[model samples]
Each structure stands twice: as C-alpha cells, then as structure tokens.
Target: MSSSSSAMLHTSPLRRYALLASNPPASTSYSTRAMAIELATLPLPASADASKFADFGREVKGVNLGSLTEEQLKEIQELLYKHDVLLFRDADVTPEQQFALTKAFDPTSAVYGHGNNKTGKTTLSILHPDLKTIPRVPQVQLIGNGMVYNHEGLAEAKLKHPHHKTFHKTHISDEDEEKGATRFYRWHIDAALYDLSPPKVTTLYGLSVPRGGKQVCRYDDGTGDELEVPLGTTAFVSGRTMFEILPPELKSLAVRSKVRYAPHPYVWMAPAHAKSTGLGIENEGLEMSFDDLPPWEQSKVKTFPILWKNPVTGGLHFQVHPCGVSELIVDPLPADAKKTGNELYPDGAHIKDLGAVRDILYKMQRPAIAPNLVYPHDWHEKDMVLFHNRGVLHTVVGAFKEDQVRAFHQCNLAASDDPIGPSEEDIKKWA
Candidate 1:
C-alpha cells in the first residue's frame, strides 16, 4: 500500500474524518461526507438574543459567581459587554467574592473609597461624615436611611459634620422628616466632576431591600404613574439606544462636540447646617460660574466627549450628565491657536452658544425617559447587579422609610482611557 493509504488506515475514524474534511478527495461523494462530519463536530455559539435573558426587574439569570469556572467567567464578561446591565438574582456573594469578580473584569481597579485620596487608599477622614465604611473593607460604603438611626431614634451622636445634616435630611421627606423623599435621587453617572477618570463598571450588591408602596415616576410621553413595586428600586436608561435614535444632526454634533465640567461637590461638601435638597434642583454652590469658583475648584474642570464609544462592544453612547455639567461648548475652537494679543479672546468667548449644547442634550433626555428604554430594577436581598457606566444612566427609584433597612455594597471597575468619540471606521463599516 502507498504511505498515505497506510497512514489513513492506522488513524482513528474521527481523526481520519477530520483530516478528510480539510482535504477532501476529488470525488463529490467524499466531499459531501467530509462536510457532514465537519458540521457534526463544531461547537454551537452562545445565545446573544436579549429576550432570552430575564426582563426588567429581574433581568438576566444563571450567574453564580461563587461556583463560576474560567469558561463561565468569560461568558459573564461577554454578557456584560453585550447587555450593559446584568442582574444576578439572589447571588448572595460575600465581600471577598464580589471583589474578586470585579477584579476579574478589571484587574487593576481598586475598591473605591468614597473620600479616599487619589490613590484610592488613604482616607480623607473629614469627608462624608454621615456615611460609614465597612471596617473590614473600607471600600464598601454603607448607604441607606437607617445607617444613621439607632434605638434612641435618629442617632444624632453618629453625625459629626455639618454636611451630615444634609445627608441625613436627604432621605426624609420635607413635609415630614420621618417620611421624607430621598434627596439624592437624580439620573447621573458617577464621578463625572472628579479629576480621576470616571469608573467604567459599577456593581451594587443589595444586602437589604425594603418592600412598600408603589414608587411614582413621570414618563417621557407626558404621563405620570406609580410603579406597583417595592421602593428603592434603581432605575436605568440605555444611553446606547438613546444615541442610536437621535436625529442625524444631533448625532453628528454629539460625535464632534465636548462638555466642560467643573467641581460642584455639594454631596461631599455641603455646609454643616444646609438643608437637604434633591439633586438637579437649585442648591447652594451648584450655580456658581467657573470664574467664581476657588482656584482649586476651578482646576477640577475637565473636558469630555459628548458621545463615547465602548471599547469592548463598539457601541456608541451619549455620555452627558445634564445635572453635573457646568458648561457646554459646541464646536469649540482649537485650544492651540496662535494669535496676536488683540486677537486672543478667552476660551469661553469662542463657544458657539451657551445654551446650544444643553438644548441638544435635552432632546436626548426626552427620548431616554420612554418606558421601552428604561429598566427599573426591583432589587431583592443579595441580588448583585453589574452595569456598564458608559452605556447606562442610573438613579434611585424612590424613597425608602427611615426604618426600612436598604443597604448596598458598591464597587467600581477602572475607567477606560480610550478617546471618546464616534465609532471607529472599521466598526462602522461592519455595521
């Protein structure tokens, strides 16, 4: 027998078939046999259809981090990039496990401490006086209406700073301190005004969830109603979907423009006796002009693109925090212009129009409120949710009673440094 024929006769049936599949003989019948064998051996692709996953309040399932293998972890990572928000129902993960899962997705991200220094370790003892960090893990912030209260009732002893009053009063209703609405409720992405790059992923583990009356919300279609669900649910809007439906003119403007944000740390620096006020409403220090702010505060000004493209998913997202932005510069002139003394005007002067940028953002905000685009998560105890900050805008759904214990441990993944703008030409070409 020939050497090729001898080798084929000695090989296993599966191996022989696989080899033939790659190099089929001249006979059409052999080619057909090879194709059939090849098809039988190939692995199937994972499902990417969003509907197959859970929906709204309980979106996404089958995530058990405690028992996750390398392959399963990779699949979760892919789902996060694809779905933007994932609700791991009743995950019941411990602090260490949560930290490990976060590190897997972002190896370099440090557990974020609310008032930690630039390195995210050294504590700034003076900040967030009303909030307490978990002693075992300082990065986990204890947030809820009940944290400050005790058997003595609204334990004034725990509050040591003027801003503590602002924090304490925020969760209570103005009409009745005991039944007040949450003052911090506002649609926003975290840390937009800070000097560091904003966090890319945020995971919130619900340790305790309060069940109560329906939470009221206004819809984009000029309709308002109460959601027949538990209080303290976190509401989210898909920024990518919002950007996709924008008018072509606004879409182009967002890709080409940038927003200017200066430090407005009211949540971190509220005066000792200042009354708690809801975010997005008029509050102290929120209206100061850039020039009016102290030099140190003015130095916090950072410019960011209006439209940001996710590196992993290649998805385009509108990245404006309307409440956080101090100024909007549309079609801003280049920063490195060479001009004579008389020709050199201030950077603010070159802004095409002051309100123009905000007007365009408002257009985006309107569509974002539609029910189809928003997902309000009705959190269950031990439910861990991981969401991409680049693709979603989230806020507190409603107020929880002071007696209701609604605690959560929040961790953030490191921010991406890739320039934010329109999608890459290659990604666009494929689309």
Candidate 2:
C-alpha cells in the first residue's frame, strides 16, 4: 500500500469513533415506508479502496428506477441522511429515471426548470453543447471537459476589464489562467451566493471515467505530495469533520459567527465570458469595496450561520466557504435588526482579523483533504453517487483531457427554511 493509503488507514479508527460520538444514531423513527422490491447492501469490491471515512458511503446492488418502490425510495432517503453519501454501482438510469429519483428525494427541487434560459424549459446543461438533452427530460445536464473549457471562456471574458486584466497578467499563470476561468476549481458550498437557500442534497451519475495519467496534488499542510490514484476523481470533505477539528477557542467563535455573501453572477453561467462582459453588466470581485457597488447590487448581501446543526443526522457542521464569503461578523444581531453596510461592521472590529479567521477555517478544512477524511470517488460507467450538501463540501480533483468524455448527470435537493443557526443547547452539547 502507498504511504498515503497507510496513513489514511492509521487514522480511520479514531476518525470513525469521533464521527460516531458526534453523530449518534438518529433517535427519531422513520415512517413505515416499504420498497416494492428488497434492496440489499453489497460488499465493496476488493479493488474498491476509496473513502477512508467508513460509513461515509455504502454500495447497494439491488434496485434501479424501473424496479424502485416507495419503500426503497424512503430507504434511500434514510441512507443519504445517515451516511451523507451513497454509491450505486452499475445504475443504468435514463435521464427521466434520474429526474424521477430526484423527485423522490424532494418534489419541489429546482431540477425541473428553465435554468437561466429565458424561453424554453432547460435544465442546467454542463455537458458539451452538442450532447442534446433527453427527449422529454431536460433537467439532467451532461457534464465533462467541455464544461471546463466553457469555464475558461468566462475567465478570459474578465480580461476585458482593465483591473482584471492587470491582476490576471500579474498573479495568474498561463495554466491557472485557463483553469481559473472555470469556477469548478474553487472549493465552495453550492448555491451559497444566491438569495435562495442552498441545496440539501446533490446526485451525480457517472457515464465515463478517465484512465491512465495520475493526478498529483500537494498536501494541504504543504508537507509533501499525494497521488490521486484515479485520474479524474470527485473529492469530498466532511463539514462535520471540519467542525470537529477546530481549535476550542475558534470553535466557540465560529459557532457564534455569521458570514455574508454577495451576488456572484458567474456561479454557473455557461459561456461566462460573453455574459459577464455583455452590455449593461458590471463585473464584481471580492477586492472591490462594498461601497463601490451599485445600491441594487449591494442589496444582494445574504447572511448565514458559520456553524450549523444538521437536523437529519443531529450533528454539528461548518457551513463556511472561504471563497464565497465576503464578510464575517461575530455574534450578529437577529435578522429583524435589518443592519446594512458599515452598520453591519461595528468599529471595524474583525475587519483585518477576518483573514485570520478564514485561515483557521481553511486549516480546519485541510484535514478533509487528508487521505483519512477525503473520499475521492473513482468513477465508473453507470455508477451513481448521492451526497448530502448539508454535511460535506466537494470539488473536482483532477483535470481531464478535452477528448475525455466524462459525462455526468447532477441533481440537487432544495434547502429547507429550518434555521441553520446553532442553539445555545447545541453549542453546549457539540462544543
């Protein structure tokens, strides 16, 4: 076994105990939902050696959309909440079938909508422009290297702006310049920049897997390097683990802190460059002063708790994403206060200190990248992985050649209005 793999195994026992202690089995009973056909959990393949965090995921071999029953649907829901991730090997599901599965999880999810297009009903298509949506089901967007190139267009579009042009030329590399254009490289919580609540769950069905060249990444601690055995893998970090590892003092502060996010138009815009630089559109960046933004744009600020309790698993998790957060205020007033701008920051208190707080959060997040906490899913055709957005942060691990057809269909469960803020009771218990 490789050193990284051995290190991961060494820490698995401790991490598993921590996870169990923090996330005790759910006491609430599930409804008597039954499946049409019994679905059985299958043993993982001997070669299947991903996911250092046991219980993070499970592989089930018994059912598909055609054979799905209400009971099986409920069981899948229960599994998703309990494990935070689920893997279905050889899941031969059609786009319509995928849509049906998403509906089973959350009927009102945004999986069926016109997305950004003004006219026809279109789901978000992350696949190559040529890959047409399934005849009647447009909700399933195909994803792969094409989506990555489309992201590059957005980055290049920013070059039209004088300030961005200078910054890119000075700080970004030819390689990074191309990659940064696509927001896929950035680690973030989904739908964080929008006014709407973020998604609760996300599902991905793999159609093609990259093979051959190894994907090498530096350790978060800058200790050395670790190789991603799978060429194109999807990496995930547990938000629960991130919260568990925080320094006691910082944990206390984080549980009480709130983060504010502004409107980020480029979140999923395809051909981003054209839309970003189009007439009447204004480019925005984190470095730009809040006061400089137009009143309407400035009004887009949305606040969320930094540390929140997951109602599903009854576990504490961090909801922070350094890239998406624009400001951090410790112990913010209730929403009724309607504070804005400078009023939001009293005495410029944590103004300069925000970076320090962010650095700590990043450090806490680093362990998730560690072999022990990280789960890099090696994709195989017909494989489907479902994960809870409320408990984990995920990103694409490696780059794929343009010719590689790494198609995937993604679906999301809409976030609930249930308060994310930790209660005094929660802080005492989880802290």
Report, for every candidate in turn, its global Cα lDDT versus the true structure. 0.51, 0.51
- Candidate 2 residue-wise lDDT at 341: 42
Q: Write the per-residue lDDT of candidate 2 for residues 102-195, one digit (tens) a residue.
A: 6555554544322322112222221223223333455555555533223211221111101122211122234743442211233456553444
Cα deviation of 419, candidate 2, in Å: 5.8
Q: For model 1, give the 10-residue run with minimal summed lDDT.
A: 35-44
TM-scores of the candidates are 0.65, 0.66
Extract clashing residue pairs from model 2. 34-71, 35-71, 35-72, 127-142, 154-273
Candidate 2: C-alpha lDDT: 0.51
Instruction: For candidate 1, write residues 228-286 as lDDT tens digits.
Output: 32366676767776677776545544555667764643333333122222223233443
Q: Candidate 1 regions off by >4 Å?
A: 1-60, 111-131, 148-184, 219-229, 264-300, 332-357, 414-419, 424-431
